[model samples]
Target: MVSEPSDAAVPGATVARLPYYLRALRDLAAQGVTTTSSSELAERSGVSSAQLRKDLSYLGSFGTRGVGYDVESLASYITVALGLETEHRLAIVGIGNLGHALANYSGYEARGFQVAALLDASPEVVGTRVAGHVVEHVDDLAAVISRDDVSMVVLATPAHVAQDVADRVVGAGVREILNFAPLALQVPDDVVVRSVDVGGELQILAFHAAARAAAL
Candidate 1:
């Protein structure tokens, strides 16, 4: 594998690929597999062996050269690299239908993110329990973030309210946001926002379907 000088920051592509490595490592461990060769894991992760080695080098060494990698050790190292060594606390805003599903999702905890608070604007659903936390009014977002020490916020509100919610959370000291609402958000350069564009993904699928039919 090619080695570059010590990186001050992980490259964007490598950061994007870290989850695949982490998932492969964890899945292997669950199967009671202790040691794995690079090629073996590459097959499991769909990342080439060379790329896997390079990606893992970001964390130091894969493991002992002759014996291959120890599954549990590698997973732990990747977890630390991904900043999940210590769990990060987060809150989900807009507890409507989409928000309710996200709040109740167990996968977040499995990946080391704990949902600390839930917020919404509707008086009808406020104080209702979904995913173990009583839904608080959206007006209380700032107080909830402070009380829970929330570092991340997930936006699940309607398209119309997404930008406002994002502004409120950022002003309340949340720098990282995962926006599930189907709308573009305007935030300061210092703040980071990741958007989940479901419609765009569906459009791509539609394009592929049209191409297949045309070929036929």
Candidate 2:
């Protein structure tokens, strides 16, 4: 019974937290739970009940007054909102240790990302087989992308050269990019880039530990 927004403007924080809610709802469904109260879902998603209610309001009112939300229906709605309805063809560029590990991960398949190709600049590594797909050379990127119809790419190249590789991918018509290199990338407004800053996360964890020690 959630109302659809005419413009569908979902806040960034709400969008990011949606996956947590979806995971919690799926867990509830697995346990034979059909309905859940807002407080229960909020606790599972690590958010306040009021915050969860506000976040869900963006997608219309799908909750009941006393019985709460339908687990299956809520999970389905979040899945659709997060665009997990279709499989996205993807490529992993750089083929370094991190890239190699990511290429072998089976989790991406479950999340709707299909790793169609793996690319690298090293001739010694190129043509090597990893995770059932042949590692193609970066020079052959356009051809590989064309052959596989890759819609997104993960950049695992060195931080210094990640932007150059990004430029190449953008030139080849890749609009969605996930960057694992420890640097920011510049791309045209038409293209979207999401970066994983591992160092920053570690620093935040260190800061929290320092704060705790200082309080002690």
The number of the candidate with the highest TM-score is: 2
In candidate 2, position 195 carries an lDDT of 90
- Return the lDDT, model 2, position 5: 44
State how far residue 154 of model 2 sits from its true place (Å).
0.8
Cα lDDT of all candidates, in order?
A: 0.88, 0.90
Q: What TM-score number comes out for model 1?
A: 0.92
lDDT of 2 by residue, 124-187 (tens): 9998999998998898888888899999999999998898889989999999999999988989
Cα misplacement distance, residue 114 of candidate 1 (Å): 1.1
Estimate the lDDT of model 2: 0.90
Against the hidden reference, what TM-scores do the models get? Answer: 0.92, 0.93
lDDT of 1: 0.88
What is the Å distance of residue 46 in model 2 from its true position? 1.4
